[model samples]
Target: MHILFLHSNYPAQFGEIAANLVAQHGDRCTFVNERVSGDQQGVKCVTYRPASGATKQTHFCAATFENQIWRSHAAAESVAQLFRSNGALAHDRPDLIVAHSGFVSALFLKEVLPEVPVVGYFEYFYHRYNSDFDFRSDLPPQSELSAMRLQARNAMLLLDLHHCEAGYCPTDFQREQIPAEYQPKLQTIFDGINTDFWKRDASLSESHATQRMVAGVTIQPYEKVVTYVSRGFESMRGSDQFLKVADQVCKKRSDVRVIVVGEDRIAYGGDARFTDGKTFRQWVIDNNDLDLSRIHFVGRVSREELIRVFSVSDAHLYWTVPFVLSWSMLNAMSCSCPVIASNTAPVQEMVRNGQNGLLVDFFDIERWVECVLQTLESPPETQRMGSNARQTIEQNYCLTSCLDKMRSLYQNVRMR
Candidate 1:
């Protein structure tokens, strides 16, 4: 079977699955993307550039919608140019097309190839009230204009839902955001982690006998190491809360050190301006009573380094609004790191409070600090939770199991 994968930024959610299919099926699989950071072996990469973004002529509310329209047209035209001549298939057309739903790349694919089925990756559906917009208290006040824009953002996704053969989301909580009428068509299948690469390293503790320096800070194996990671230090990921909790932990325990991994910028929930003329990171540091000496902000590191960090961490902190789940949290769990996560929808699905990991209310700073300190104080309990965390990933969210389920889903879609 000829399978075609699509994502504006190539090799994202589809990277592992596409690469696996190419290795197993050889030249039978191809990937169509807008751009790729690195090349993938055993797969054909086709690049397509969408038209420029919105301009002054575009209506304010419709600007977001118009950008998607451009993407839809550009992707459709690019795919056609590659495989068509005189409005006919000039090369072997795809038997099945799997695409990310946010970009509208597959919006026109059905119009181009009426027979081939398209399976969409449904990551998130926006809502004004019980969603990311309202999940956090630190965010700026919402307005009617912002609400309208948020509503318009879903124009493309709604279109894809109606046109695509089937759809899948990474978590059940994310799948719930979609309209009830469309829920039957969407299934939950996490973009799994590579267990072999992320598994706990038995030699990590023994190899580093003396004090070790990570991100320019010295940390002895005997010291309590609490770690937090996100793509950016933003409100959506609960960076603010993490900093506060770190302050509390530092005051109680002098041996504890907090390692933060992420850039100091806003990636989600829009820009939040501080009265002190400091970035969110700086604002947190200045306002909180944290010991600057114990906090280490390490910008983005490589995947290998990330796994190693997770392996050595005493407790991993992960918090986010009720949105798409972070893959880093799963990787931390796969590395047998005890996780203290927010009691949100996406996290609750994976972390059973007091089971694999402890969950605290997102805004409950005292409880968050207590959980982290408890995990640090009790080595035996922490070890048990860490073991259970790894088991959770191995059984459900590992690459091997997720890929098998993906292949079966694709076959079912194709058969229909």
Candidate 2:
């Protein structure tokens, strides 16, 4: 079987699946992406670039959709070039195309290879309210133009959903955001975690673990380490609340250390609404009375370093509004860290209160502080919860199970 994978960023969420298929089936798998960073182990990668650039004159509302169309056109042209038998390099057509939905690459592929089945990765469906933008109370008020742009961004998403044979969302909470009629064609499959690599290391001890430290802060086994990770220090992930509670915790406890892993930039939503010219991290520092020495803001670390932090942490703090889930939370769970997460749809889907981990209200800084204190105070209970958290990931969100589901989806679409 010949499978083609499409993503604007090379191997976005489809990396594991694409690599697995290539390993199992050898040269039958190919990846077409907008990036040509390097080579993969057993897959052929073809790169594409937008034929036209977004001009300054492009209307703000239509700019996003126009850029998506440019990506679709460029990817379609690259795929067409591969099929030209007269070209220097000719490749056979794919049996199936798997792509990220919002880019509209798969939609254009349908026009080129009309008979082939395309599986779209439906990550999220934007909305004017009740979505990422309005989930937080701290965000600045939205304008009519901003709301219109948000609606306009979904133009390609709706079209992709209509044309694709099947779509997969990482969580059912996300799948519910799509139109009800399209829900049947969508399946829930998590972007699974590698439990073997992320598991707790029993051999790691205070004496030996000092060799590798997070941002040069050596964590002693006697001190309780609390960790918070996100793609960025932004409002959607509740970075503000986390920092406020971190300040509170630091003032109350002497033996606790806070390690935050993320950049100061905003990954989602508007910028820091309170500050005139400050990053979110800078704003948090300027407004709050936090102990600079107790908190370590390690911008971002490698995968191995993250696993190390998760392994040694006594408690992991994951706060977010009712938005898309972060893989950082799941990865922490997989590493058996006692997680204190916000009670949102995505977090609630994976974490059960008093079972695997503890959940708290997103806005309640007191409850968040209490939960972290509880985890730090109770050693046996924290270890038990960590054990349960690892078990949860192993049972439901492991790599093997998710890949099996993906393969089944592929077969179902191919047979149809």
Candidate 3:
């Protein structure tokens, strides 16, 4: 089948799925993207770079926002114009259209080729808004600014949802957010990790040997490293809470270390340099007078580096409010890295709490600290949980299984 895939960023969640299909079925896949990032496992990818510039979140200006969302439509129109200019699409329309709803491409693709079956990657649907904005009742009266920002963002999905033939959500939690009326077309697919690259069998001592040596000493295996991975240290991620609890944990125990991996900008409510507030990163840096030396931040690293981080850690630290859990958690599981995630929908499903990994109260700093401390106190139990974590991924979320689901779903959608 000649499949046309649309995503704002090529080879993201949709890119992996698209690449998987081409490798397994020899399907010719054309990917229209906002930016050209990189090549993939195995796929024929054709990119459509919009003549317009990248989307910017400037001071509230109606004209600027419209230009950003509609850029993809303008670009897809160019795709149709290019086809008409060459009589290409007219000769052979795509068998199916896979789109990502968070982007503008799906709506424009619908306009360009009225007959193509359009399936979308339904990343999110935010009708209720970011409650985290109001979550802090203690810090004076609340402002609706964040909620307003989220509501304004919700308007972007309306066109994409109405035009889709089907929607694929990476997690059941994400799927649940869509309205019941739209749920008929929703399908759940596990966003997975490449187990081959992630799965490592080195002993604890061996794994500890390669860990980042700060001031030239193997981060001792005796130290219980609770690691958190993400794109930043931000509010939604509860990075601040993680760090705050790390402070609490540090005072209570000497053998514990808090390691944060991933960039901190746009993480702890934007980077410290630009954003006025002391983001969790800056907070950690400021509070180094305490046992804060144990609180460590590992700068952003590549995928292979992340696997190594996951492999050596005793626990995968996670603190999310409404944000989606990072792929790092799945990679951690593949590496048999036990996770201590917030009890949110997707996380609740992933972690069986004391089974594969532990789940803590999202906002309860004391409880979160206790859970982290528990893992350190009980090394044997933690190791057993880590083993089970890997087993769970092997059974349900391995790369091969995800590919199988993708190809099967594509066939089913195409057959219709």
User: In model 3, which residue pairs have backbone atoms overlapping below 3 Å?
Assistant: 233-267, 233-268, 234-267, 234-268
What's the TM for model 2? 0.94
Candidate 2 on 309-410: residue-level lDDT in tens? 887788999987767888899999998999999988889999999999999999999998898998899989998999999999999999888888988888
Superposed by TM-score, candidate 3 places the C-alpha of residue 47 at a distance from the truth, in angstroms, of: 3.5
lDDT of each: 0.83, 0.83, 0.70
lDDT of 3: 0.70
lDDT against true structure, model 1: 0.83
Residue 94 error for model 3, in Å? 2.3
Q: Which lDDT value does model 1 have at 165?
A: 87
TM-score of 1: 0.94
Model 1: CA > 4 A from native: 25-27, 37-39, 85-91, 206-208, 273-278
| Alpha-carbon shift of residue 308 in model 1 (angstroms) | 1.4
TM-score of 3: 0.87
TM-score against native, each model: 0.94, 0.94, 0.87
* Cα-based lDDT at residue 229, candidate 1: 95
lDDT of 2: 0.83
- Report lDDT (Cα) of residue 130, candidate 2: 76
